[model samples]
Structure formats: structure tokens, C-alpha cells
Target: GDSDRLKVGELVASLSYPFGRESSLSFGIISRRGRSRSVSAGFDFIQTNAGASAGSSGGPLVNIKGETVGMVTMASQNGTMGFAIPISVIKNLLPRLERGEKIVWGWLGVRVSELTLEAADKLGLSPAKGVFVNSVVAGQPAEKGNILPHDVIVAVNGVEIDNPREFTRMISGAEAGSEVRLTIFRQGGLLQRSVILAPRPQESGGGREG
Candidate 1:
């Protein structure tokens, strides 16, 4: 995803009650984007100084006209700043909640790491960006799709990916039984493959953490 989805200068609004009386409006911007550095394995979060509070929990944080973006959940005790899960990710999760369905992830059974310049060059890649497939499970999607070790994935479903986080993010967004197109650079050439994503088999021994 790109910053275009978020309009920084636009007034980001939220409902709050400083004294827990009645709902009051507060505003901020897309202060920052990306995950909280402290959460080792969480989706990207939006950082804002909007007056979120405990009483305001579950209230929609939105744009000026109140286009739902996120729920007011946390704030700093010292009134320094606050955090929010981005609307892009929220839009993906709320539907499941409404359906009373649990969130599940499709596992590829691969342990990948971001490729460094030297490592990418060793693999004959023209550019040194994206995640490198370190290993793949014998019978998982990575293996089934012939995602070879050392392959540098540059995109998923036509979306350009430059890191392991983005790679996993794109895959997680895809629905089970649907197909995803992958762009990979291997040896000295580029390759494209379509993988029919399957729900991570619960019985499978190998898996990715959800």
C-alpha cells in the first residue's frame, strides 16, 4: 500500500470525552505510518495525537466528514501522543468481525529474510530489494508454487513488494481459494507464477505464525 490512501494534511477526526461526560470531537492528521516499532509482529499502525481516551473506546476515528478510519483505543498519560491501527488494515478485518468469523492466515511455510545488496548480487539479481526465500516447506504453498530458495520476490498480485513484511501482508490480504500472481527475480531473469492460495492446513506441521 502507498501513502496515497491517506491524506496527511486532511483533518483526521475522532470522538473523545476528556472527563467521560459526553462525546466530543478531536482532530489530528496521519502523523506517521507503519507499525509500532515495539510490536515485533503486527500490521502497520497509524500514529496520531488525536484525543483518544478510554471512554471513547470503539468510537470511529475518521476524516472531517466522518468517513470511518479507526476506533479510538489508546493515548498517552502525559498527553504526548497516541496510536491507532490504520484504516486500510481495519477495513480488511471488520467484515470478519461482523460475520463472527475468526481471523485465519494462509501459510506458505517459508522462512525469508530481507535480501541485502551483496546477497542479491550473489543471486544474480539486477536490484537488491525485496525478500529472499531462505527455505520452503516440502508440501506448502511456497513449495507447491515452486518458490525456490534464493528467489527474490518483487511483488504479489501486481503490487510491488520490497520487504518480507510487505510480502506477507499481501498474501494475508488474499482470500483462500483465490489465485495470486507473484513476480520473482531468479538467477539473471524474471519469472511470474500464479499460486492458488489455500487456507493454512491446520494438520500441517510447518506453518507461519499468524
Candidate 2:
């Protein structure tokens, strides 16, 4: 059994066998909880400075309550940081993993770019934020929900969206067929639409947030 739920800034303990020192342990705060800005596209990472060294890969990252939150995946080249794949990602793929099936993320089918200051001002957005829709896949959830190319997505299920990556992170994390309310800015007007996310199929052309 393992834990999948955790929060940002939560205290965590890393159980490792650094340099074969069995029963070794290290402590650190969760420095970041969202998608890693450094990596292009992958699962969200739990960033920390927990001194994970050789022989630490696959070790459990437990919370202060001794609940596993993530598993150490890799270390930075500079040795100043460590990256862990959130247990939720693993939990979602476990069944497929057991069945020897390929894993895929949820798809929203909208190509988007970060909202630029120029576009924001022209679009009457007081602050430049969120992301601009570039295109929508044919017959996908976005097109069905009237998510157009010019629309700027401001929030998802009432959670404020800041950038393209964050938008992708939120949507991918959502369960397929789950209803999501999207708050959008279009032609100087605010609109809301509920969309049902779909599972991204292997080799399919699912749009990306840029």
C-alpha cells in the first residue's frame, strides 16, 4: 500500500540507503508541487533538496505523518535538487502498468499559447495571464464546448490558470469524462462552459499548451 495525496510545502522525509548506508534518512520541505518548468512535457514532479544520492532512486518520499507521497526518480546534474514523480501519477497508471499497457494522459484537444502582454491589452485583460487558444481539434471537447482559437482560458473548475503549462497540468490531472467548468475571456467578454475531458489515445494528435 502507498499514499497518493500530498500538498505543497508539506514536510517530507526521504528514506534512502545513501552510499549503502542502510536506514539512512533525510528531511526537506516540498519546494514545488506543480509541473517542473525545466522539463517540457511529463508528469508533475515533487521538487526538494533532500540530499538523495546514489542508491536513492525508487526510494519512498514520505510525509511528516509517515505517508508516502512520491518516489524519487532522478537527481539534478548539479546535485542541488531532486525530482520525484507524484504518487498520484503512479496510482493512476498502476492498473495499466500491471496489465503491461501503455500509459496516456487526458486530452482537452486545444492548442494554446501563453497570453502575451500585447494580446492581453488588446483583448482588454487588465493583467496579462492565462493562455490563448490557438486551435481546437476537430470534434473534440474544446470544439464541442465552443472553445475557440481566440478565447483566453482564465480558470478551470474555479481554479485560476496562470500559464499554458499549468493549464495542461490541470487538465491532464483531471479524470476523463469528469465535468470541468472553464472560465474564458473572449472578445472582451467572460464566458463559462462545461466540458468533459477525454483520454488521449496513443499516437493521436492531441494538442499541447505552449
Candidate 3:
């Protein structure tokens, strides 16, 4: 019964006010969920194939039972696909929005990629499935914590990391000034370090989390 959670292939519909056309119904289904597109601070969106026209956003996307599941955010450049911010995210930020507070994003300030088998072999890792640190932004949490480039992160707070999304998920939930423990693989050795997170800078951009 949770509106925040949805399954792939689930039936979904929208009531849009596209170009001032209110109450216009479009039929479609959830193509995917928990999709994050890079933007300011970034938010996970529900991917749908629901047809929408100009101004379709600011409208409600509903489930079969007429529950408002999401709100249209943008259409693809070619209008072939649509993205909607999950209502759960809005609800989570509503309190701050209501209080007229600026939204803050958790910042780790590190760019990462998936560990490839070749890289694993180069790094002497077997069966590599961990996240690889590509770069670290200076003056940010990762850099401040001495998370150098080429350090392969294997875990966070004792939880094994399998991909970049898991890494972002862990950091996104963290508050500024909160300390996080990271397990890193550097030069054929495993090391652990504690990092204190900071709020994302005003001009920062979010990375895609699929």
C-alpha cells in the first residue's frame, strides 16, 4: 500500500493539465523506478511511457487505484519518454519547503565508476564487483578524508558496495557533518577511514544513479 514503492510493468495513468488542458487523461505503465538523472542535488524519478504534451508537468501521475504516485517533471528532448519526481521525495522535502528553507544536498564530492575485470586484475583484485573511485573533488568530504583517486571502495559502514548507486544511496542518506566509515582498497591493501560529510556546494551537480 506504499505509494513510494512501485513495481515494473505496473499499471499507471496520469491526469494532466497539458497546455492548460486540465483533467486530460493519459494511459501508460511504470517502465522503471528509482531512476536518478543528474541535476541539481538530484532526485530519483519514476520512468513512465505515459504520453504527455507541453505543460503536462505539474500534473498528477496515479496508480490503478487512483493514488497519486508521482508528478511529471520533464519529457525527453524528443518527447519519446517522460520522467516524474517520485511523490515520496516531495513529501520528504515538503517540511523544509513549507518552512521556506533552502533544500540541502548531501555531498561526498567523489566521482566513481564500476570496477572492471581488467582494472581488478591490474589492481590485483579477484572477481571485482566493487565501485572504483574515478576522481575526488578537492575540499570535499572524500578528498578531506584522503580518498584518493584509484582507491577502490569496497564497503560503507560495513555494508558491501556493489555499484555507484549503493555508494550514492549511502551518502545521500547522510547528513552534513555526519561521520561515515569507508573501506577502501589501495595498492593491494584494504584500509578503513572515517569521513565527515559536508553539504553540497551551491553550484554542484548530481551524478546519475541508475
Candidate 4:
């Protein structure tokens, strides 16, 4: 089944062994599509109203035609909301996993936040776009590349971006040690910076932002 074809309000079911019990099915509709990567533990997920519990993670989320569209990942404490990693994401990683390759997340070493309309106005921009750099980790790629705080990242490799989550996805998807061109806005002027991404560290410490 095409996960990309899934839409809000579409009926779906999840098969899981909650509480270590036998596999059971929970029915629900797609409450939301395309959960942000930042909020979904670095993977894009779809929000469902499906009831899931402990031990439900890694179960299949099936559509009406009995096609697996996603994998159950997590549920809210109250069990009212659930999230599933879309099949698209799984498909992309399957080949690499099968080849025994370790997943490497690209690191940028910068903390960023949303740039609101008010902030955009003060910056003399009409439309609010891009992410505002909050801090740069010392000795990291961003700092090494001369990316400073107060700079606005508007594009990556010439592709316009307006959301921090999107930026995270783009950077994390890129291979480590690859050079990327960043278009930044600073002091009402636009400039470009080339930064070579580093591999994400296992233990979170000095730099962790993707």
C-alpha cells in the first residue's frame, strides 16, 4: 500500500500484543498525516486515533484492504492518541538494514527555533520564513563553519525551507561528511555558508541538533 496515499479520516487498524498478551487489533481513523520528525523521535509518523498500549511498538498498521501501511511506534499516556512510522520511512531503511549498515544521522550542531511573524517583521521580512538559530555548539560543524547565533537559515542547498522540522529532516537525511550550502539571513542581508556535516554522537552532550 502507498503510505503517501493515506489521508486523514481514512480507516485503519493496528495489530499488537499489548501487555504481552496475544496479538489484538485496534480500529481507528487517521487523525493526522505527516507528524513532524522532531516530535516523532527523528522519524516521520502518522497520527492515529487507534488505541495502543505497552508492547505495541513495531506492530503493523493495516489499511482496510489488509495492506500494511505503517508500523505502530507509540501512544499517549491516556491511550487516546497513537503514532505509526509510515511505511515510506521503513521502506527507505530496509535495504540498508538488510545490508547490515549502521544508521548514521547527520549533525549540524546548532539549536534552532521557529521564526515567528513578529520576529520576521522586526527583521524587515514580509513573510515569516526560515528558522532562527538559538545557539551554536563550540567546536562543532556550525561553529567551525562560522554559523553564529542570530542568523536565520532560509534554505539548504538552494531549497527554501520554513520549518525547523523540515530542516532537521533534510540535514539528518544527508550523509555525514557531505558538504551542504546554507542560505542564511543576517542583519537584513543574505549570505551563503558551506558546512560539512558530522556524524551524530551516540551520547548527547556538546552538539546534538540534526
lDDT score for residue 148 of model 1 = 89
lDDT of 2 by residue, 1-210 (tens): 233345567788888876666677888877876442211133456777764566667888888778777888667667767777777666766887799975445677889888889999999998877889988988888988899998999987777887785677677656566677899998888999998777765565333542
Best by TM-score: 4
Query: How well does each candidate superpose onto the true structure, as a TM-score?
Result: 0.62, 0.66, 0.65, 0.70
- Top-scoring candidate (lDDT): 4
Better of 2 and 4 by TM-score: 4
Model 4 has an lDDT value of 0.78
lDDT of 3 by residue, 1-210 (tens): 244578889888877866764467888878867443332334455778774556778778888988888888767667766777777767766787899976655777888888988999999977796789888887888887899999998987776777775576656655566667889999998999988778866676454221
Cα lDDT tens digits for candidate 1, 1-210: 332266555567777765667778777776755442211122444557675444555556776665766666556566645555566666657777799987655556577787888897787776677788888778777788898887877876666766775566556545566667778888878899877766766775222221
Q: List clashing residue pairs in candidate 4.
A: none
Candidate 2 at residue 10, lDDT?
73
Candidate 4 similarity to native, TM-score: 0.70
Over the full model, what C-alpha lDDT does candidate 2 score relative to the true structure? 0.73
Task: State, as a TM-score between 0 and 1, how close model 3 is to the true structure.
Answer: 0.65
Model 2 clash pairs are: none
